[model samples]
Target: MSLIVRVAARGDGITADGRHAASAAPGDTLTDTGEVIPGPHHQPPPCRHFPECGGCQLQHLDDDSYAAFVADRIATALAAQGIEADLRPTALSPPRTRRRATLHAEGGLIGFTEQASHRIVDMRECHVLHPALFVLVGPLRALVQRLRPKGRVELHLTLADQGVDLLVKATLPPGLAAAEAITAFAQAHALARLSIDEGYGPEARWEPQPVTVTLGGTPVALPSAAFLQATAEGEAALVAAVREATAGAATVADLFAGLGTFALALPAKVYAAEGARDAHLALKAASAQRPLFTEHRDLFRRPLTVAELDRFDAIVLDPPRAGAREQIAKIEAAKTPRLAYVSCNPSSFARDAKALCEGGWRLDWVQPVGQFRWSTHVELAARFSR
Candidate 1:
């Protein structure tokens, strides 16, 4: 028998001899015949959809082992880039804390897609979603039934200050009858807001009051399909790390600033730039009274040049999964004195870190964040100083 050693980047278990096993957890043993024997770190998955639903992949791992796996992912990414830094302890978000998620509705079922398949898992219970968000699953299913939506429908749910904000993308257009049913459903559930996308952009069907999400201690109007951190705890962890990294800076540039996650939180005079129009406007409106400057610019298409970047005392950027390659190039050229990088994908982060390091910046430390718990996803906040 071979012992399962670690979980790979895609959630598959790797054995001692380097063979991958599906649905195997660390400490589990694989027989020569390919049967898996559960070990100490293995536990019964809390969700019945486990091993089938694509929502979670590491639920079989114990708490300690799961945390280790999350840290290892970051370590491996840095190692690949030949970049070493002091790695802080991994911060794992507790279950039932996920504030935003996208579920699929198709074939009379609504839930996450099945692992390695396009079929929906038809979620009966979700351990990761906040109770507020999960409670609407049944109501949404009922609404789908009433509307009899054809083909596949995508549902995006996020917890706002008022309540759950839902956006539905349906293949079939909602007629008068379907629209009435959606409105009734939203009213019955007391939803904060409900919108549907029928080829065009999302059109609000019900909104009793304004929908907003409080970020950096301020309430910003929530826009449909706007970017947000997955969990509140995870967002707090990242914010704390960023604050520590850029403490005492008088001026800070927040590139790729989505709705002012770091811009509004930082004490410095912030200059926030984002490509998304809605997010930029939301941040601008929320930061009108604060010492924050918001700009609607595409960083990738036209990254802030060295001259433009030199105006800030410190830089903090949270780019998408692809990482801020273009912006990091400018930052490298500028030799920014201080930088705090928040990333959801470690591979791209490491790649960018190498560029910064080669440009004479030191990779100080990284705070690993396991926001999407029980999954291969890894996020981190790192400090770079020249």
Candidate 2:
């Protein structure tokens, strides 16, 4: 038998382990459920839909509490390798920093999934996205409703400097034709670019245009398809952190230097290597006329040799999620003196940090940047000395 008992949670009941507690009171024991349920007030996000909506689990937790969660994770990972490091307080981007999101486009109507279920939650307003994108949601939905695209579409809404970029990946059925209509809608809304993908398989039709964004009052552009940190302030914070970690350095090598975000910010003579031609071009364009120069090439396939490493005093890496394992291996072989590693994934960062320590380097400091807020993600910059 189920009872409508009030949960201790502020004003709503609580759910545990995917099962609703018989009562809504805190620390209530229900024999029917055969479990002890903590009261609602003890839980975060007193909303009745909390346990259902996957949107925010830490709503019940304050910022200080959440900072502890991230700190523990980082501390544990570092302690395992006999490294002593402090996990600083987390930094967050202002509300609506999520410039891009992939919403499900079904039957020409776009929507996002509910917290825990595949059930779509038709949303005309997203709180975490930029205002420019937020305003477009309604118009975009109206356009989709009119078009009624045949198959489920992956609609990408990006915040570009000049305007928004709308990328739609879907197949359209005859009679419900709205390709030109969609493009016209975007143009009418003053969107910067509107790209559509229509192919299938590994070779999908996608755009290779550069994603231009103005950072620090300067236009910084990179391949739209390449990896980019989500938020503007987040990227700026990362650049600042890396600069703080590598200050007073004489010569530096920025491996996997995407757009030279770190290299361009540093005063040292930097040797940047990017895997893509587009990124390399943007980086060169940014560094042109300046004393700093870059080489267009891949870093992992053919890493800098020991003799090559002799040209630089320190190395800073901002590799993709897979991390700079190959480049680290080369540095280990070369016995590089100092290094600074920036990563979005802690697990990969820990692994590479271990490799560096084993190769005669010591962990100096670790700074955590809460780039992606309201999510279980962390970004960090670690300094090491040989």
Candidate 3:
């Protein structure tokens, strides 16, 4: 029998001899008969959809084991680039803390997609979603049934200040009856807001008041399909790291600033840049009384040049999954003294870290964050100084 020593990046268990076993947890043993002997690290998955639903993969592992998996993922990514840093203790968000999620509905089945398949799991209970979000599952199902969508529909749910903000992506066009039914559903649920997306972008069907998400101690209007952190605790963890990383900086530039998550919270005067028109406007509106400047610019295509970057004493950037190669290049050439990089993907973060390291910036430390708990996804915030 071979012992499952560790977990791979994709949630597969790796044996001592480097054999990958599906659905195997660390400390489990693989027998010659192709069976897995459950180990101490293996815990009964809370969700019955485990091994089927694609939403979660590491639920079978104990809390300690899961934290190690999250830390190891960042360590492995850094090792790949021959970069070393002080890897801090992993911060794992508690179960039932997820505030944002996207669910699929089709043929009266509404839930996440099946593992490696397109079929929906018809979720009865979700262990990851916040109690507020989970309660809306039934209401969403009723809305889908009333719409009678010919094909699959997507439901994007986010917990807002008032209540859950529900967005339904329907396949067919909504008629008079469908619209009335949706309006009633919103009022019955007392949802913060409800919007529907046909072929074009999402349009508000029912909103008693303006929809807003409080970030950095301020309420910012939440545009349709707005990007937000997965969990509240996770957002706090990331924000704390950013604050510590940029402490004492007089002026800071927040790139890819969505609704001023870090800009408004920082103590220094912040110049925030965002590409989305709605997000940019929301940030601008929210920063009216603060010393925060807002700009709408696509950082990927036209990253701040070295001259533009030099205006700030420090910088903070949270780019998408692909990472900010272009922006990092300019930072490397600039005289910015400090940087706080928050990333959702470790591989890309390490790649960008390599560039900064080679360009004279020191990789101070990295704080691993598990926003999407019971899953293989990883997020981190790091500090870089020149």
Candidate 4:
């Protein structure tokens, strides 16, 4: 028998003697013929849809092993770039804490899609969704049957300041009669807002009040289409890390600042730049009372040049999965003293980190944030100084 040494970046288990085993955790025993025997680090998955549901991947790993997985992912990525830092303890968000999610609907069923397939799981019970969000699953199932959505439909559910904000995107446009049914569903569910997209854009069908998401003690108007961190706990951890990384900087630049997640949280005179019109407008309106400036600039097309990058004491970048390749190159050229980078993709982040380190910047530390609990998807905040 061989011992499962570690979990791979793609959620598979690797044995010491060069073998991959599915559904096996660290410390598990692997038989010669490929039977996985659970060990100390292995535990029963909390969700009934384990190994089938695509929403979560590491549910079988205990908390300790799961935290190790989060840390190891970052370590592995940094190692590839010939870089290392003070890897801090990983912050694991508790189960049932996810406040924002995208669920699929088909054939009167509502749930996450299956792993590596187009099929839906038709979730009967979920362990990762918050109590408030999961409460509407049954109602949503019935509503889908009534609406009879043609083709695949996507339901974007987010917990706004008022209540659950739901956006339904379906192939069939809502007719006048369907509008009535949608309104009724929204009202019955006490939803904060509801919108529908028919390939055009999201049009609000029901909104009793303007939906806003409170960040940094200010309520920023959450546009129908906006991005937010997966879980509140994860957001808190990331915010704390960024704040610590950029502490004492009087002037800061928040690039790709979606709804001022890090810009508003920092007390410095922040110059927040965002590409999306709604997000830029919302951040401008929300931070009118604070020492913050807003700019609707697309970093991908036109990154801040070295001359422009030298205007801040520190910069905070929270780029998308693609990472901020262009911005990092500018940073390399500029004389910016420090920066705190928040990234959702480790491989992309590692590439950026390599450039930063090669440019004479020092990687101080890294803090991993596993917001999507039991999932292989990882996020982190890091500090770099020159």
Q: Per-prediction TM-score, please?
A: 0.97, 0.79, 0.98, 0.98
**Residue-wise lDDT of candidate 1 within 1-386, one digit each (tens)?**
89999989988889978988887889899999988899888888899889789999989888888888888898999999998889999999999999999999876689999988999999899999999999988878777876777788999999999998999998655468777788888898888999988879999989999899999899999998678999999999999999999999999999999898899899889999999999999999999899998899999999999999899899998999999899988999895699999999999999999999999899999999999989888999999999
Better of 2 and 4 by lDDT: 4
lDDT of 2 at 90: 64
- Give model 3's TM-score versus the native structure: 0.98
lDDT of 3 at 324: 97
lDDT (Cα atoms) of all candidates against the true structure: 0.90, 0.66, 0.91, 0.93
In terms of TM-score, how similar is model 2 to the real structure? Answer: 0.79
Worst 10 residues of 2 by lDDT: 3-12
- List where candidate 4 sits over 4 angstroms from the true fold: 173-175
Candidate 2 local Cα displacement, residue 356, angstroms: 1.0
Off by over 4 Å in 1: 172-174
Worst 10 residues of 3 by lDDT: 170-179
Which number leads on lDDT?
A: 4
* Model 2 stretches with alpha carbons more than 4 Å out: 1-57, 114-119, 173-177, 200-211
Q: Per-residue lDDT tens digits of candidate 2, residues 142-184?
A: 7767766666777777787667777777665554246567656
Better of 1 and 4 by TM-score: 4
Clashing pairs in 3: none
Clash number for candidate 3:
0
lDDT of 2 at 2: 35
